[model samples]
Target: MEAEDGKLKCNCPSGTFGEDCSLGVCEIENPCLNGGTCVPASNIADTPSCICPPGTFQPVCEQCYYNFTRDAYIQLDSQVMLAINSLNQTQCDEECDKDERCTFNFIGLDGCYIFEKPVIFASGNGDLNKYKERCMQMEECLLLTHILEDNKCFLFNVTLNNALSILRLIEGQHGNNIAEKICC
Candidate 1:
């Protein structure tokens, strides 16, 4: 839900309750349709209000603002694709979308940047102050596809790769073996 003053607007369906619209409604998770907050179902108040953004209506954040993460940082050390020239949050997402090694990473100097992946350790204050980060627009495009494993090159649903696969796993010392499973 679009949490403003923590006052949620439960947009529960016809016969439902709670901040999230899940209780009476078994349709979806959280039940807070359209990014609404599921209010706690009470004898007094029944129905979840979907706290949508200003321009959005109920049921979902349909016309509302796009969702993004904030205060994110890569853990431990940075496997940084270094020397990005002045990047903005949009560019950060764009970069993450393009990179294969980047599970998720973001610049720490801006308002908020977000990338989604597993968790890693955050950098220390001393390390954080060492370098400068910028978000200026630049002209660059990087497409990387390499053999990460013996016979496996990850190439499905890459953020910017247009759902295409690149490279074929050739023979290896361990005798190249290719088994296709759900993208792990």
Candidate 2:
């Protein structure tokens, strides 16, 4: 039959045939190699062509070139961030290993950043209970000051003794001064 362009149509003699004889029927052995995708040609023939994705390049899409490694991570600021512009996992690992300060690597959308050091806290000395108690007491005292001064407590970093002295001074000024200020 005559095709839309008035060309004579026939089953592809090349062992590939489809609408208007325009389909690529690669051999069962897969003529397109190296991860190449075979697509039917637009022409009135059963021939197919290969289209390769990134990190791969070949006429038959059978081979991957160097420098196309996957994603990887690096350490940064006591955190494991991902490396930038890493193509494959192998490349990413290699890059991270090259840095002495790097402790760990992580892969993410934004690539990697190297952590120079890990975070540390004094609580490692098994004094966590004491530290927690001190912090809680400090917070409670701060809250008490806020309550006694109404919601407008002036910020200060007074020592515990100094804070008590201030409280005494306020108490001496007037019996109900603290309560009046707080309620108002």
Candidate 3:
């Protein structure tokens, strides 16, 4: 306690509170969630704040994060796949896993696999023209996918020139449509 204006006032240390600094701020109940750490407020009247971990946010860390189980992966459709001739699933997996630049292996639902660097830029609900205009604004965007059912756009930095080297388009096949960046 320190004397201020002829009256003694209680001053608590870090993380401690109450009349004599005898109680802990986090002693009663912790409010932080999703691996977040609770930090006691400097003033006794103020509430504690939470330090959220990676892939989590908000006051108590209650937010949507990619919470996938171990060994889980998302399967890509044919439109985004790069055709590697004469290579089976095992061979494709081995080749992609060995390549240092190929961090993500996009295994197609039809048993095909892509070796391209899957650097996704943006994804949101929009029409084809809207996605194309948005992609054109970004110099790095090289590919775009617009899902008709959900009206979702997925922009990527994968080059068409690079994709053309390995991909062989199957004529008349239908699913998702991929738009490549065209030069003037």
Q: In terms of TM-score, which candidate is strongest?
A: 3
Per-model TM against the reference: 0.20, 0.22, 0.31
Task: Tell me the lDDT of candidate 3.
Answer: 0.56
Task: Provide the lowest-lDDT 10-residue window in model 2.
Answer: 175-184
**Per-residue CA lDDT of candidate 2, range 59-101, in tens?**
5553321121112111112232334664465665677689775
At residue 149, candidate 3 shows an lDDT of: 51
Q: How many clashing pairs in candidate 2?
A: 20
Q: lDDT ranking from best to worst?
A: 3, 2, 1
> Cα RMSD to native, each candidate?
17.6, 27.1, 13.7
lDDT of 3 by residue, 88-113 (tens): 66877787777666533433433434
Q: Please name the candidate that would achieve the greatest lDDT relative to the true structure.
A: 3
Off by over 4 Å in 2: 1-24, 27-29, 44-47, 64-184
Total backbone collisions for each predicted model: 32, 20, 0
lDDT of each: 0.34, 0.37, 0.56
